[model samples]
Target: MSINKTNRSSLRYQSIKNDGYIMERLEELAKQNPVEGFWKCYGRIRNSGTIVNHKKLHRLYKKMGLPLRRKIKKRLPARVKEPLAVPAYFTQTWSIDFYE
Candidate 1:
Protein backbone atom coordinates (compact mmCIF):
# COMPACT_ATOMS: atom_id res chain seq x y z
CA MET A 1 0.00 0.00 0.00
CA SER A 2 1.44 3.37 -1.11
CA ILE A 3 0.45 6.87 0.19
CA ASN A 4 -1.09 9.11 -2.52
CA LYS A 5 -1.75 12.88 -2.38
CA THR A 6 -5.20 14.23 -3.32
CA ASN A 7 -5.39 16.23 -6.57
CA ARG A 8 -5.61 20.08 -6.20
CA SER A 9 -8.22 20.48 -9.02
CA SER A 10 -10.85 18.55 -7.05
CA LEU A 11 -10.37 20.87 -4.01
CA ARG A 12 -13.03 23.51 -4.57
CA TYR A 13 -15.06 25.64 -2.17
CA GLN A 14 -18.79 25.56 -2.64
CA SER A 15 -21.21 28.20 -1.35
CA ILE A 16 -24.06 27.26 0.94
CA LYS A 17 -26.97 25.83 -1.02
CA ASN A 18 -30.02 28.04 -0.92
CA ASP A 19 -33.07 27.05 -2.89
CA GLY A 20 -34.62 29.93 -4.83
CA TYR A 21 -38.05 28.32 -4.75
CA ILE A 22 -38.02 28.25 -0.96
CA MET A 23 -36.93 31.87 -0.82
CA GLU A 24 -39.68 32.88 -3.23
CA ARG A 25 -42.28 30.91 -1.33
CA LEU A 26 -41.12 32.51 1.94
CA GLU A 27 -41.17 35.95 0.36
CA GLU A 28 -44.71 35.46 -0.91
CA LEU A 29 -45.91 34.18 2.42
CA ALA A 30 -44.07 36.97 4.23
CA LYS A 31 -45.77 39.55 2.06
CA GLN A 32 -49.16 37.90 2.53
CA ASN A 33 -48.74 37.66 6.32
CA PRO A 34 -46.30 40.19 7.72
CA VAL A 35 -47.17 39.80 11.38
CA GLU A 36 -46.26 36.14 11.80
CA GLY A 37 -42.70 35.08 12.63
CA PHE A 38 -40.36 32.08 12.42
CA TRP A 39 -42.56 29.36 13.92
CA LYS A 40 -45.45 30.39 11.73
CA CYS A 41 -43.29 30.34 8.60
CA TYR A 42 -41.78 27.08 9.67
CA GLY A 43 -45.20 25.49 10.05
CA ARG A 44 -46.41 26.89 6.76
CA ILE A 45 -43.44 25.52 4.82
CA ARG A 46 -43.50 22.24 6.71
CA ASN A 47 -47.18 21.80 5.87
CA SER A 48 -46.44 22.68 2.27
CA GLY A 49 -43.92 19.76 2.12
CA THR A 50 -40.83 21.92 2.57
CA ILE A 51 -38.82 21.16 5.67
CA VAL A 52 -36.39 23.91 6.68
CA ASN A 53 -34.19 24.58 9.67
CA HIS A 54 -35.40 27.29 12.05
CA LYS A 55 -32.05 29.10 12.23
CA LYS A 56 -31.67 29.12 8.45
CA LEU A 57 -35.24 30.31 8.00
CA HIS A 58 -34.77 33.12 10.53
CA ARG A 59 -31.42 34.14 9.03
CA LEU A 60 -32.99 34.26 5.59
CA TYR A 61 -36.04 36.03 6.95
CA LYS A 62 -33.82 38.77 8.45
CA LYS A 63 -31.77 38.88 5.27
CA MET A 64 -34.99 39.49 3.33
CA GLY A 65 -35.77 42.35 5.74
CA LEU A 66 -39.11 41.00 6.87
CA PRO A 67 -40.37 43.03 9.80
CA LEU A 68 -42.38 41.38 12.55
CA ARG A 69 -45.52 43.25 13.42
CA ARG A 70 -45.99 44.42 16.98
CA LYS A 71 -48.47 42.41 18.99
CA ILE A 72 -51.41 44.37 20.39
CA LYS A 73 -52.81 43.34 23.74
CA LYS A 74 -56.43 42.23 23.77
CA ARG A 75 -58.47 43.82 26.53
CA LEU A 76 -61.93 42.89 27.82
CA PRO A 77 -64.56 45.58 27.45
CA ALA A 78 -65.77 47.25 30.61
CA ARG A 79 -68.97 45.64 31.90
CA VAL A 80 -72.12 47.73 32.33
CA LYS A 81 -73.40 47.82 35.89
CA GLU A 82 -77.04 47.00 36.51
CA PRO A 83 -79.05 48.39 39.43
CA LEU A 84 -79.87 45.88 42.20
CA ALA A 85 -83.39 44.45 42.01
CA VAL A 86 -85.72 45.42 44.88
CA PRO A 87 -87.51 42.62 46.71
CA ALA A 88 -91.26 42.44 46.10
CA TYR A 89 -91.94 41.45 49.73
CA PHE A 90 -90.29 42.38 53.05
CA THR A 91 -90.06 38.69 53.99
CA GLN A 92 -88.32 37.89 50.71
CA THR A 93 -85.40 40.21 51.51
CA TRP A 94 -83.22 39.20 54.48
CA SER A 95 -80.58 41.67 55.49
CA ILE A 96 -77.44 40.74 57.36
CA ASP A 97 -75.58 43.19 59.59
CA PHE A 98 -71.83 42.79 59.85
CA TYR A 99 -69.55 44.49 62.41
CA GLU A 100 -66.13 44.29 60.84
Candidate 2:
Protein backbone atom coordinates (compact mmCIF):
# COMPACT_ATOMS: atom_id res chain seq x y z
CA MET A 1 0.00 0.00 0.00
CA SER A 2 1.24 3.42 -1.00
CA ILE A 3 -0.82 5.27 1.66
CA ASN A 4 0.85 7.43 4.34
CA LYS A 5 1.08 5.60 7.73
CA THR A 6 -0.14 8.65 9.68
CA ASN A 7 -3.18 9.10 7.40
CA ARG A 8 -4.02 5.38 7.60
CA SER A 9 -3.73 5.45 11.40
CA SER A 10 -6.00 8.52 11.68
CA LEU A 11 -8.61 6.90 9.43
CA ARG A 12 -8.57 3.72 11.50
CA TYR A 13 -9.18 5.66 14.76
CA GLN A 14 -11.88 8.03 13.44
CA SER A 15 -15.22 7.69 15.28
CA ILE A 16 -18.59 8.28 13.63
CA LYS A 17 -20.97 10.70 15.41
CA ASN A 18 -24.54 9.62 16.15
CA ASP A 19 -27.14 11.40 13.99
CA GLY A 20 -30.09 10.19 16.08
CA TYR A 21 -31.15 13.71 17.08
CA ILE A 22 -31.57 14.89 13.50
CA MET A 23 -33.25 11.62 12.53
CA GLU A 24 -35.75 12.01 15.38
CA ARG A 25 -36.51 15.60 14.45
CA LEU A 26 -37.04 14.64 10.81
CA GLU A 27 -39.31 11.74 11.77
CA GLU A 28 -41.34 14.01 14.05
CA LEU A 29 -41.80 16.55 11.29
CA ALA A 30 -42.82 13.81 8.88
CA LYS A 31 -45.41 12.46 11.30
CA GLN A 32 -46.84 15.95 11.88
CA ASN A 33 -47.01 16.79 8.20
CA PRO A 34 -47.31 13.68 6.10
CA VAL A 35 -48.43 15.56 2.99
CA GLU A 36 -45.44 17.93 2.85
CA GLY A 37 -42.22 16.96 1.08
CA PHE A 38 -38.54 17.09 2.10
CA TRP A 39 -38.07 20.78 1.28
CA LYS A 40 -40.90 21.76 3.60
CA CYS A 41 -39.38 19.67 6.37
CA TYR A 42 -36.00 21.24 5.71
CA GLY A 43 -37.56 24.70 5.97
CA ARG A 44 -39.20 23.84 9.27
CA ILE A 45 -35.90 22.53 10.68
CA ARG A 46 -34.06 25.61 9.44
CA ASN A 47 -36.68 27.89 11.03
CA SER A 48 -36.22 26.07 14.32
CA GLY A 49 -32.49 27.12 14.29
CA THR A 50 -30.98 23.86 13.08
CA ILE A 51 -28.40 24.60 10.38
CA VAL A 52 -28.34 21.21 8.64
CA ASN A 53 -27.12 21.21 5.05
CA HIS A 54 -29.77 20.33 2.44
CA LYS A 55 -27.66 17.53 0.93
CA LYS A 56 -27.03 15.95 4.32
CA LEU A 57 -30.68 16.28 5.26
CA HIS A 58 -31.69 14.66 1.99
CA ARG A 59 -29.31 11.77 2.54
CA LEU A 60 -30.61 11.24 6.07
CA TYR A 61 -34.19 11.52 4.87
CA LYS A 62 -33.58 8.80 2.27
CA LYS A 63 -31.78 6.62 4.80
CA MET A 64 -34.82 6.88 7.09
CA GLY A 65 -37.23 6.04 4.18
CA LEU A 66 -39.25 9.23 4.49
CA PRO A 67 -40.05 10.06 0.89
CA LEU A 68 -43.44 11.63 0.19
CA ARG A 69 -45.83 9.66 -2.01
CA ARG A 70 -46.65 11.22 -5.36
CA LYS A 71 -50.30 12.12 -5.77
CA ILE A 72 -52.05 10.85 -8.91
CA LYS A 73 -54.25 13.30 -10.79
CA LYS A 74 -57.92 12.44 -11.01
CA ARG A 75 -59.21 11.58 -14.48
CA LEU A 76 -61.93 13.85 -15.82
CA PRO A 77 -65.33 12.32 -16.54
CA ALA A 78 -66.15 11.82 -20.20
CA ARG A 79 -68.13 14.77 -21.68
CA VAL A 80 -71.76 14.09 -22.68
CA LYS A 81 -72.33 14.15 -26.43
CA GLU A 82 -75.10 16.53 -27.53
CA PRO A 83 -76.68 16.63 -30.95
CA LEU A 84 -76.56 20.03 -32.71
CA ALA A 85 -79.96 21.46 -33.71
CA VAL A 86 -80.28 22.88 -37.22
CA PRO A 87 -82.13 26.21 -37.59
CA ALA A 88 -85.27 26.02 -39.76
CA TYR A 89 -84.88 29.67 -40.79
CA PHE A 90 -81.81 31.54 -42.06
CA THR A 91 -82.14 34.34 -39.36
CA GLN A 92 -82.70 31.83 -36.56
CA THR A 93 -79.02 32.35 -35.57
CA TRP A 94 -77.67 35.86 -36.13
CA SER A 95 -74.03 36.81 -35.80
CA ILE A 96 -72.45 40.25 -35.61
CA ASP A 97 -68.75 40.98 -36.08
CA PHE A 98 -67.02 44.25 -35.13
CA TYR A 99 -63.76 45.27 -36.84
CA GLU A 100 -61.27 47.33 -34.91
Candidate 3:
Protein backbone atom coordinates (compact mmCIF):
# COMPACT_ATOMS: atom_id res chain seq x y z
CA MET A 1 0.00 0.00 0.00
CA SER A 2 1.30 3.48 -0.94
CA ILE A 3 0.10 7.11 -0.97
CA ASN A 4 0.64 9.31 -4.02
CA LYS A 5 1.93 12.92 -3.88
CA THR A 6 -1.36 14.15 -5.32
CA ASN A 7 -3.25 12.42 -2.48
CA ARG A 8 -1.17 14.18 0.15
CA SER A 9 -1.88 17.89 0.08
CA SER A 10 -1.44 20.79 2.47
CA LEU A 11 -3.01 20.11 5.87
CA ARG A 12 -5.97 22.26 6.90
CA TYR A 13 -5.46 23.92 10.31
CA GLN A 14 -8.39 24.74 12.59
CA SER A 15 -8.29 26.84 15.76
CA ILE A 16 -10.13 25.65 18.85
CA LYS A 17 -10.35 29.23 20.19
CA ASN A 18 -11.84 30.60 17.00
CA ASP A 19 -14.14 27.58 16.75
CA GLY A 20 -15.70 28.50 20.09
CA TYR A 21 -16.37 32.06 18.96
CA ILE A 22 -17.67 30.91 15.59
CA MET A 23 -19.94 28.30 17.13
CA GLU A 24 -21.41 30.78 19.60
CA ARG A 25 -22.09 33.35 16.87
CA LEU A 26 -23.46 30.68 14.49
CA GLU A 27 -25.99 29.49 17.06
CA GLU A 28 -27.02 33.05 17.87
CA LEU A 29 -27.63 33.90 14.22
CA ALA A 30 -29.33 30.55 13.54
CA LYS A 31 -31.85 31.35 16.26
CA GLN A 32 -32.75 34.55 14.47
CA ASN A 33 -32.59 33.13 10.94
CA PRO A 34 -33.10 29.38 10.87
CA VAL A 35 -31.53 28.98 7.42
CA GLU A 36 -28.50 31.24 7.80
CA GLY A 37 -25.28 30.40 5.90
CA PHE A 38 -21.66 30.71 6.93
CA TRP A 39 -20.81 32.75 3.81
CA LYS A 40 -23.52 35.27 4.67
CA CYS A 41 -22.31 35.57 8.25
CA TYR A 42 -18.72 35.79 6.95
CA GLY A 43 -19.67 38.72 4.75
CA ARG A 44 -21.47 40.45 7.63
CA ILE A 45 -18.56 39.95 10.00
CA ARG A 46 -16.10 41.13 7.35
CA ASN A 47 -18.24 44.17 6.60
CA SER A 48 -18.18 44.95 10.31
CA GLY A 49 -14.31 44.99 10.09
CA THR A 50 -13.93 41.60 11.80
CA ILE A 51 -12.20 39.99 8.84
CA VAL A 52 -11.42 36.24 8.96
CA ASN A 53 -10.83 33.35 6.59
CA HIS A 54 -13.94 31.99 4.86
CA LYS A 55 -12.51 28.46 4.98
CA LYS A 56 -12.15 28.62 8.75
CA LEU A 57 -15.63 30.01 9.18
CA HIS A 58 -17.01 27.32 6.87
CA ARG A 59 -15.40 24.56 8.90
CA LEU A 60 -16.54 26.04 12.21
CA TYR A 61 -20.04 26.53 10.82
CA LYS A 62 -20.31 22.81 9.99
CA LYS A 63 -18.90 21.82 13.38
CA MET A 64 -21.66 23.92 14.95
CA GLY A 65 -24.36 22.04 12.91
CA LEU A 66 -25.12 24.75 10.35
CA PRO A 67 -26.06 23.61 6.83
CA LEU A 68 -26.81 24.94 3.33
CA ARG A 69 -29.84 27.13 2.67
CA ARG A 70 -33.11 25.67 1.42
CA LYS A 71 -35.53 27.25 -1.04
CA ILE A 72 -38.85 28.58 0.38
CA LYS A 73 -41.67 30.08 -1.62
CA LYS A 74 -42.93 33.46 -0.42
CA ARG A 75 -46.49 33.77 0.91
CA LEU A 76 -49.12 35.19 -1.41
CA PRO A 77 -50.76 38.58 -0.78
CA ALA A 78 -54.16 38.56 0.97
CA ARG A 79 -57.32 39.56 -0.88
CA VAL A 80 -59.24 42.60 0.45
CA LYS A 81 -62.98 42.99 0.08
CA GLU A 82 -64.42 46.18 -1.36
CA PRO A 83 -66.84 48.28 0.75
CA LEU A 84 -70.50 47.93 -0.25
CA ALA A 85 -73.04 50.71 -0.29
CA VAL A 86 -74.79 51.05 3.10
CA PRO A 87 -78.54 50.27 3.21
CA ALA A 88 -81.01 52.85 4.63
CA TYR A 89 -82.58 50.13 6.80
CA PHE A 90 -80.77 49.38 10.09
CA THR A 91 -81.43 45.61 9.86
CA GLN A 92 -80.18 45.47 6.25
CA THR A 93 -76.63 46.63 6.96
CA TRP A 94 -74.13 44.46 8.83
CA SER A 95 -70.36 44.97 9.18
CA ILE A 96 -67.69 42.67 10.52
CA ASP A 97 -64.09 43.38 11.39
CA PHE A 98 -61.57 40.63 12.12
CA TYR A 99 -59.53 43.07 14.20
CA GLU A 100 -62.21 42.98 16.82
Per-residue lDDT tens digits of candidate 2, residues 1-100? 3355455555666689678989999999999999899999999999999889999999999999999788899999999999998899998997999999
Q: How does candidate 3 score on lDDT?
A: 0.72
Whichever of 2 and 3 has more TM-score, that candidate is 2
The parts of candidate 3 lying over 4 Å away from their true place are 1-17, 69-100
Model 1 bad stretches (over 4 Å): 1-3, 7-16, 69-100
Across residues 1-44, which tens digit of lDDT does each residue of candidate 1 receive? 22456666556676889678788988989888877886788799
Q: Please, what are the lDDT tens digits per residue for candidate 3 over residues 38-97? A: 677887767877667888878777777678757799998998989988799899977787
Error of 3 at 52 (Å): 1.3
Question: Between candidates 1 and 2, which one is better according to lDDT?
Answer: 2
